[model samples]
Target chain A: MTEDVPVKVNGLNHWFGKGEARKQALFDVNLKVAGGSLTVLVGPSGSGKTTLLTLAGCLRDVQHGSIRLLGQELNGAHSDLQRALRRRLGFIFQAHNLHGSLTALQNVLMGLQVHGRSDPVLQAKAARHILTLLGLGDRMDYLPDNLSGGQKQRVAVARALVGNPDIVFADEPTAALDRESGATVVQMLKRLGQVRGTTTVMVTHDNRILELADRIVTLEDGRIVNDTAP
Target chain B: MSLLLQALFGRLPIGWLQLTHNRTRFAAALAGVAFANVLVFVQLGIMNSMATATLKPYGFFQADIMISASDANSMTEGSNVARQWMYQAMADPDVVAGTGLFVATVTWQRTDKALGLTTYGIDPTQPIFLSPEMATRAATLQLPNSGILDRFTRGLPRDETAAIRPQSPLSFEANNITLTLYDTFAGGGGFGGDGFMMVSDQTFLQQFPARSSGAPDHILLQVAAGADPDVVAARLRDLVSDKSLRIRSYAQAAAEDLSYQQTKRPTGIIFGFGVVIGVLVGIVIVYQVLSTDVADHLSEYATFKAIGYGQGFFLSVVFEQALVLGMLGFVPGLAVASLLLWAMASATTLPLAMTAGMAVTVFIGTVVACSLSGAIATRRLVAADPADLF
Candidate 1:
């Protein structure tokens, strides 16, 4: 599990616009995420935590840094290469972002569909298995609108993990859930990271789940202020 | 390939479901598309109806060959030919039978009622090439003072008994023509309103005092079996050396009639412009609706991208949605246009024929518009960053 870095960002700096409009979103950020570990990034509002997470997730263009996930450099990748790289990375957001028209099971199956996998039976089976693991077995047929907030987040988590990506990036996934549901989601994410041996990076403002993370990184302004392993 | 199929077909149901889920938005979009179709189809139907009405009178002339002046492009602008031409045509060995006819617009009055009517002068004794039904009508007609009034004008009483006020002075130089009713020809109206009369040459000259020299407008000829109409037409052309006189077979006349309608009448041009406007409106509406929907669900698209959905998959969804909306709107629009055409047929003398070709053309046009709009609107999805979901 400790053999190599799952995500590496070298002197990453990102700014929005130029001149007077220029504002640094990420500043001289350098970090390494070890494989098969649950890393939590905690920060206050406007701390540029999301910017750093987006850069590491290959969702944004780097202005003055190098970013590599699973040893593939994303600094100058073409559009197609970037898409391929994105297919190998799973992302979860504060909102479920589940297709309101699709059922929970279908939402999970969409993960495989995004990767251009068309085997519906296999996809369905994997989706069901993931939902069951996430304690959402009974809600598979419910649409996002029909499910409770906690169930919606769980479905989103299942969607992220269903693709079997090398790394999972979650941005405030538990922000919209109650305390108990948030804890359950964090615990489930941690368990999946350990069992699947996949790197998990979750950005959150909730400190209650800090003990559940294998490592905690705090962000102040746009730089990492503290890194602690427990 | 399977992935594309699944995304195209499988995602289609979801897209439709989403559309249906939002009843208000879906209805608005459907209404916009349907209105566009209605506008296009109605304009086309009216154009067809006008063309049909203009050509209805000639439908009965079954002669394989006809000769008229080259400048007489349509029924409205035909030129006069001498009765001697019919006799000259009959001299050909291949000529079976021929007749001389004159068509003109004339003002008629009985008592006080006066109106303009299309008047056809034909020799009733000869085997005229006109429809048998019209011939029967011509045979049964009673010419008052030697002039026969068509069924359209027959409702008016004779000049002696009628009490209606005349819009024009009643003039009967040689004889007074009494009105008589007969069977009506469908869509027989000419450039003017739907009132026409048929009469003998002598009665026509009597009723129309302005025609000091009576002349037939055209010659109708019937070729004997095994006789080539082209050869007879050529001979007629050679005999009539004056450039003002040109010979045309019935086929040539029909072709010329179509060309005249296509070029001279504003019906085709106006309707063509209508169709273009409909297509443009459809594209704009479709683009706006689909673009809004895509923007509303942009996050979901990003999530799909994050999970690995290809750009092709996103594009397929947009296309499927467009097709669904187009089809949904098309069926109702066609039905509405057909209803309007039927209602119009009853109220007016125009003949509106909605053919399968028209339907096919309209459907193809709608589909193309929708597809183009969807393709343009989905460009944002292609440039979207999947990692934005994080």
Candidate 2:
């Protein structure tokens, strides 16, 4: 692996439960993601795709091997280090996870605020710019409850991108959108990654998203079965 | 609220957002806090009333120092101190004048109800009343079997007030003791008695034939100009070899009586427990609201954790909510308690005012209670695992 790779995973393993119920979730997973590459983890259920994504994102403890995110090793990383590293990353979960009491613009701003402090005016401007890019310019003040399912999912995507993170981890990013909105969000993610050198590692089953990926790593039963760049 | 929180922390008030999102839950939580505040305020007010009532009789005198029987626990309940103590106190150069005070709680029958009339028996010659009007009015007790009644007594009827004036005396029989009310005063009712009446030493002895003139319940003495009452009292304590008498400055006696009533009386103990119960109820209610809220958004909290939000940020939100509930709830609770206390003071003639000290204490207590509940409620949320959010 090159020294400049943004995400480098070597000999990674994971397990769940204890004693008689203990079961392995991943087996010696190894991968290197270059800067600005859109790498899609494609696998069936229980294939440990999410487990690898979380380990690489520094979202969980690395139980067995070495995983470096943004040149810092994740194994035995202190909480302050993990937290500082997390500030440079973004995430899009399947559930959208928008705060019900906050408006669309506020939810998007939360993405930027985790980095400590910034100009509130600039933060709002950046959030508005991102929300508008996702075709939610008019719904910026609407709470999550008032938004439709597709609108909420688009807002989540906007939040993950508004902070201008160096890297983004997404799970089923376009699962709730219609074809037009879905295509728009996918195009935005691709443009941001390619032009701005924002690395993206996503666990997705969307065929359109997979086709546009710079690299695809397929997994079955916790081990990578295929890797191709085409 | 969001704007206010933003101003304070310059960050998203996640706690305020979560609380306000569910309108019903927030209102219920606030109401719980308010109820607790009201409970504390009212109990404190009742305790205040106990002290006020216990020291009511002390207000009737202008003495710099007082001598009571050692058996006296409060101003109202005591046996007798000999009149010779008064004569002994008057001899000192610091002592100008003194009076022997005889007290007896007599049961008076008012048609269907029985009331306690605390009758003060005093010498017509010596002055002890704080009120100049009362001192003049008390002189009328010099007339045979005549006395002055407390017009502000709790159960005194409207018709009796009109009938018992200085010009028109109302003759009545209390416990087969003949007494004619020639005047009235402003000393209100208290826990010690439903009313009070003053009489001459001769009339008082006639009313209680078994009692003697040599021994009175208490002795009140006035000190000379610019002399400290405590110093005079100390001098008297040294001069009087009687170990069975309690000698102190009048102010010290009243202060001790107030504390004794508040700490040692059954009313004080029961009201103190009321305050504790109120705090506990408040904690439970707030905890239920906050805990349910945390549970409902477990997945979202896990997502926040994954998004690089620290435990401190989350805790800030919950504590902000706690502070909001405490401060806002105290407003309505204090207002209601004030109105109730004022009404009670007039209707029952107990000195039950809502003091500044009581208000400040209850306010701090409310904030602490709500914060404690918030801390307990956030226990599970702080442990939210970002790994399981998927």
Candidate 3:
């Protein structure tokens, strides 16, 4: 795992449809994310930063580019391989899309359950431990509707980390939080990537938190324009 | 497989939690299902009750064979057999006993009041296989023009010396007959209403002067023990080459009656339509319900899909929800049907019995309907590209 590149994208181009209505969402994007590194992508709205992250995460279908995660080429791979990529990748969204019907702990355990794990007690314990580490130890039984904004985001972070994914993708994860809560979330993500050796790619418009990134890449339009780290 | 099962059953708590979270929506959906069930079950119950009412007349009979006019296809209208057919039938070694039966519609009177009724004329000496209650009542019944009156037709006595004044318009004399409401048979023969009378042959002839020629309409036969009715019936047909009369074993008659009900009556057609409607309604409702629920949780589903949850897994969850609703709705539907049948049975002579086979059939039908809807509704999840979530 130490020698493996967590994510690599080269000349990735994606279009929505055919004919005149076709619109390019990502264009000639090239980037590499090293293992155990915190990479932040900063861009304006619709700058394709999220598209780049999704492409690297194997969440979107790539049309005209190559992507390799953990030494496995995603382009032209079988459905099973693609599924394996998703299983090993963790994703966090800004909205904290936790299920309203499930409690905070159950939402975290849902990650493991989705990956076909059947041990309820083990899943529960792992989810509880992750939530506890994220400062949500007392809110395990709280449903999404019952949780505050900051608590919900923490629960979402717990869910992303519960499976111990090789790579974690966070898109504007702190956009809905206040300044204090947002800083705390950024610190937690930095520690997760730097201390635990989990490669993390975050897309955000908040440049104030750029200092927490091990490497920061700037994107304009759909291509990377600058990089602060070699 | 175990994981799938766990997810399938594990979702029950989630489903309940969601339902409780929104009580109004849950109640609305449940009510929709319950209403659909009630419509289907009530329609089916009516059809079943109609069939039972149609067959009730034969239920009380104990004849092994029924010999009617050769062209007679039903009990309502058939050519008459000669009274001597009874003697001829009894003469056969295989025949242990035989009776003449006269069936006709006649107008009866109790002191100037008159009403039409179906008359069953039987030999007083021979046993009437159709209704023993009617047989017992026949003994005490007097001949026509001077006899007892049925509870429905019996009126107060009238003056006997009364005569019409001179130059009055001609008035027809109404036949006075006795009627005893000893037996009440259900009145469903693919027709509208029911009224029947059972009387002795002498009394019937006296009342219905047009039928006085002693020509029996049908002859019922009782086969001797260890006798084959089919063989005896074939032999009888040979003996009576007159194509005017037909002889049929009881089993054949029962089969023909069942076939007639299935093919000729509207019960089968209506019930079949009802079942089709039920399936279609169930599919639409279940599909809409599960599909809406999925759509409501689209983001959550996308999250699961991003975490390697296969299309099959999500499909299973949808199927489980449909099945749960189907089972829940089915229990109440069947219970309502049973209650309706019981109430109908008490009010009318219809026999509405629910068998294990019917229950199984309904259960399978509900499951299949729900599963089909579930499968169709979840196609969106299968084709969903997780990349869109970003």
Candidate 4:
């Protein structure tokens, strides 16, 4: 509940298939993520880093053990509770899954719209404000089809942060960006953690991002092999 | 458009935005829906016109009540009742006049186009016609081998129908006997024939040598002024000792005949199946479009789920798109159908019209039909898991 730990996991396990084709993804994993801190999950392909991130972010059903996210148990929870818990969270995929038909501004507005925001004038204002901060002020009216890869990723970033979620879970948020933009994005997350007490958990293999992480947790073959505080 | 959408749904019209995103697909889907609408409208139009045509001959006669054999089914193709029923019906105080009309279908040769003309043979002596204009025209048929033709008949020579007056008569050979038509009437085509022909009882005998005047196809009775036709009809039923006669008010008999044509005929069944085919075509076309769109945007929908948008939200988007496509397509479909119906009505001289009842029925039917397709298309998106997107 305090700044020491906002995300606590105990002996969490998850599987991918069933019966003869059953396969395990995570096994007896345990960790605590401090509030207002950037925790990075780094691993090679099929190393279970993405699996652990999605499990902790409420993106998948927690199969076994307990995961207390923002003081709420997620294992075997009702769908209503899961959806309510998800509303207070944010997610950024590596592909930047922005709606192709929506403009940059509308895409950001969707972040707030899921929470059933009623005020149109203020919602548009807030959406515009966040897009402007992401250096997409001139591209607010441009559709995703009209934007480049890096620009579309920024729109996705603006969409995730516009709602001011309690915690952000990103899977390679900067993969589609150049060095300067990726550096700017990581700095923005770091600055938000210090100024607004917003927690961020990202899974990435970017070397430049490793230098700025407050803590690094690496997974290999479905188990934590190394944990370090930089 | 936005205001209408806001009234029905919320301010953010996500469905409309997504449907309008791909211009080519939207246009194609709209056209498909419109084509289906046209198919349905045309079928319903023809079916409705048949209902109206079946009752056309009833308006030509001037009877307050009619008597036919109890086993009779419709105006045409029914057993002929004994002519003694006319005298028995006239015994009532409300019975002012009566007539024995002989009706039968016969083929007439026009030197170019053969016509199936329903012959209504009367004495031309009783008050048997509703309009004085028709009565005046029928009076000319009293002469031997003389008759009047229906100008409103389909496929009739336009100038010939107009020129064949008393001064300019036209002769036609039919049933191996030549008859000359010296006048015309306003009666149109119906289920019995392509047109109507007025003849004397003697001429009707010549047309059908075996049909005796002792029995007529129907008995028409004219009740006294300010008297209830229903009351006189009921009295006739009791006074007539014949159990084979079916006495009914003029309006009631025509209504029963129309219903009989709509429900118990081969043409009715064909039109009903035609309507079913049209609806099925519409559902299949809309399903293809909506299912394809859902497949293309699977990842985006999964992202919405990751963002906590529920299954209900996705349903609304697809349903909204369906409603928009159906309504837009119906507008053009209605316009095109009305024009075609107008042209058909003019050529056939039937009471084919675009009514408000018909429009409202099609509008509601299309909406419900398209929504069913939309519901089916969303089943795949419901199964898409957010975990798979990572």
Best prediction by DockQ: 2
Q: How much is A35 displaced in model 4, in angstroms? A: 2.9
Best by lDDT: 4
What TM-score does each of the candidates earn?
0.83, 0.93, 0.81, 0.91
Task: Provide DockQ values for all models, in the order shown.
Answer: 0.51, 0.66, 0.52, 0.65
Stretches of candidate 4 exceeding 4 Å from the true structure: A1-6, B2-8, B62-65, B86-98, B128-138, B141-146, B164-169, B176-182, B200-203, B221-248, B342-353
CA displacement after TM-score superposition, residue A83 of candidate 1 (Å):
1.6
lDDT of each candidate versus the true structure? 0.73, 0.84, 0.70, 0.85
By TM-score, highest first, what's the ranking? 2, 4, 1, 3
Q: Give per-residue CA lDDT, model 3, range B1-390, as digits (tens).
A: 335445656632444454445667766666656556666666666666556645554554557787887656555457888867767777788888877777776664445566455556666666446456545544443333222222222121212102212222112234644333322322322232234455667766776777755577777788988999999988887776465677888667666666666557576677768867876887788788877887787777787778787777777677766676677778877777677767765454344555565567777777787788878888767555666677
- Superposed by TM-score, candidate 2 places the C-alpha of residue A196 at a distance from the truth, in angstroms, of 2.2
Residue B378 deviation, candidate 4, in Å?
A: 1.9
- Native contacts kept (model 4): 0.64
TM-score of chain A of 4: 0.97
Q: After superposition, how far is residue B33 of candidate 4 from its true place, in Å?
A: 0.6
Candidate 4, residue B337: Cα displacement in angstroms equals 2.7
What would the per-residue lDDT of candidate 4 be over residues B1-390, giving only the tens digit for each residue? Answer: 755874577646777778789999989999999888888887788878887778777877788898988766677768888888788888898998887878898788666788899887887776454457668776687788898888877778679799988999999888888899999988776656788888888899888899999888888888988999888888888999996688998888888887777777888778888888998998998888888888888888888888888888899888988899889989988898888888988877766778787789888888998999999999989766888767
- Candidate 3 Cα deviation (angstroms), residue B164: 35
Q: Residue B231 in candidate 3 has what lDDT?
A: 90
Answer with 2 or 3, whichever has the higher TM-score.
2
> What fraction of correct interface contacts does each candidate retain?
0.74, 0.62, 0.68, 0.64
True-structure lDDT of candidate 1: 0.73
Model 3 chain A: weakest 10-residue lDDT segment is: A1-10
